[model samples]
Target: MTTLKALKGQHHVSAITANAMKNYEFYTKILGLRLVKKTVNQDDTSVYHLFFADERGNPGTDLTFFEIPRAGHTYYGSNSVSTTSLRVPKDASLEYWKNRFNEFEIEHDEISIVSGRATLAFRDFEGQRLALVSDENNVGVAGGKPWDKSPVALEHAIVGLGPVTLTVQNISALSSVLKDIMGYREKGKYEAEGHEVVVFETGEGGTGAEVHVVARPDLPAERPGRGSVHHVAFRVENQEELIKWANYLKELRIPNSGFVERYYFKSLYFREPNGILFELATDGPGFEGDEPFETLGENLSLPLYFEAQRKEIEAKLKPLDTREGGKN
Candidate 1:
């Protein structure tokens, strides 16, 4: 078996949201993530595509969304990404977030230790599950860049993405895919909120490396809609690694969208055994590719191919209120 080498950590997590403004408020105002890009979905130009991240909009920091008002609520069940966890510095940092959430009236659970790390669970306005995991080991945070202007204190700002949890019908094949093909190793196991969970870690076993699988065979299959995760993307070093990943998938007889140029980064998408969508994306040619860093997210950005239709696309999108200095 060929051992995977290029896979690093999470590249970005993309999900669906019903309202662009609401999603923006939650991630930017509430969570204090930087609004890195304001664009439209490449495949569906009518809906807005938003990207939120830390200072530089680094690979692991990105959490993107597609706005589709009529998409309806998500049906959570087997083969769905259940939660996206953001990493915070240990104990003191978690305390800061707990107080911050309370001050803002954002609902969150009490801190609890899971898989040997303290975690604070919460959900966004649209009911998209999220959590804040305290990583005392520093994990991937040593290299994180914080947005200085964020409402939250610099020391306590969300460092980066932590482990993402997936609910699957069976863990067998998915476990093999993660371990063998994805280069993740089984770390530990624990029960969380009444469900049996298994932990898997990617490169170096830190913040962005964790992937939690929760077996839920009795639940119905998930139906995608608003607030559902569209796909969970893992990071590859660059385009070369992305292409290699695509070829590797084919060698394993796994069906995938080979070598997709996603504008910001190259990507390859494939569905795991339990139907959860996974993507391997490159790290370069980021948010600043279209707009200057200082003016990022100020105006709608379109790919080169869509430049000719910019006027039509902008006319269709609902006007966004980008005023700063207050919570929604």
Candidate 2:
């Protein structure tokens, strides 16, 4: 059975060029997320793997990165997949980001909300689309940390993904898949001209996050390339729940991308009925196992797999100073 006791909701990582330093500044100084891990890609030494998260760089709080220089700007069309929708606390902190965007000259727009919550939309240094949201509950970055000069008594940070959108040529086809096959319920419209935004909060949630899906009927097929979202992960309670999801996908004859070992997590990937890439990940032994909560994101840490080759990899990877992803 694919059921387990708990499932870590997400482990967000970026796919960008080799500008490691700029990312450091934006994530730490500007956005306020602590730099959890500094390491190079195990498979590709020339590239790096940077992790950012809450006080401890926990799985759900994490927004990781991959530096891939040669990758070009992603094309935004109908077929293009929806990547990440980040949630922020939604108060004066939003003003912080707004002014920060102005100060750093980061391009962004305020997202419209009906009866749900307030949201701000922006992109990462890598051009992957991202969102900042404020919802009913104020649960986020560990309290007592100073964000900006203000004593941000709450966690004003990237909590996790709000939702991933999928644009299908045939709306009805995707709709059926989401309903009959996937256990997703329709949330509501988040866009005026685009496809409807569908959502599904975790029935067995460990935190207070909601998944949103904004369908784009007017777009063309998306090509997977650099700076684009690799995939979106969904959370299950445990291994038993994971296998149950696998079996459910099997029942629909969906192809499993295979189980991937993310070190801190184990995940199974497959496209849902609407063609949105879905990952089922376990929650446990989070980022803390690699670094202490006190010193997370301050330095680089590598798994045993890449520890020996740090020197050689460091030479190939370029400094983020060369390519600044953030405006400021």
Candidate 3:
């Protein structure tokens, strides 16, 4: 089989959290992604499952959430297991995020470049490690970074993710998964923050092409708690493609890390023998199907299970802050 060259796109990366409302404010109000979908976890009701993404709620722009059951406080272990980094248009990083954070009074740390690009590092409301990188080759956004109060002109803000970091005890197993199953090509290796990080390039790396995997040797394993990465999703072409990878994992005898229908995509999950979790995600029938861009995340979008309770659903949902954030 020809080794996979690059990821098809990013569907959604999920995280477990304690407060669904808090997640809403941070991702939609603070980070500036649109709350494309809001509903309860079908697997378990009473727990909120949310999604945030770019203008049209495209597959690659998606970042998802799962409110865990009676979650406990979290701790950030040694090194970051995974960091969701978005690719921004060159020159938009400093002005855009700097002023945006300052205006909102959101605290963040600035890094010109940890490895190969100008990056601004910060934590989200959920304590997720995130970065905004001004990629030299960024193609910019179609709607011109539609979020509000950005220091840089909307024309040059982040279009979508540039890359990401995934931790593993050893690179051998995870690396093989990346090369054989995920279609990622090793870009090169670089030293940063006192650790050697390997970078992989996926797609054009801006829209559907932006995926990155790193072999984090020094990062300690993070216990799944209130605040931790629940999962990282790598996009595939469709359900058919998702099945092939799912069977491949089964053939490898990788345990229950297999495909599950996620409404929009199909997914398979497994941990590298070293204990790092990995997933193969698919993309289709994305967020726009439920809501328009101008009014996203402002209302409740439920699955068929909750269709009869739109009123109950809308009433139960916490009110969306009507305040137009200057820096969101």
Q: Give me the candidate number with maximum lDDT.
A: 1
Question: Each model's C-alpha lDDT?
Answer: 0.84, 0.56, 0.63
Relative to the true structure, candidate 2 reaches a TM of 0.77
Q: What digit string (tens of lDDT, one per residue) describes model 2 on residues 1-328?
A: 3323333334453445445666677666666666656666655667777866665545556666776766666776554455555556555557767777777777788755532656677876666676676644544322212222222224465544444445556666656655555554454555534445555443333223344445556666676555576555555555556666677667657799555656666678876555656667766456667767555544555666777877776667664442222223
lDDT of 2 at 259: 57
**Backbone clashes in each candidate structure, one number apiece?**
0, 33, 12
Per-candidate Cα RMSD to the true structure, in Å, reads 1.9, 4.7, 3.9
lDDT of 1: 0.84
Off by over 4 Å in 1: 1-4, 140-143, 323-328
Report model 3's TM-score to 2 decimal places: 0.81
Q: Rank the candidates by TM-score, best first.
A: 1, 3, 2
Q: Per-residue lDDT for 78 in model 2?
A: 51
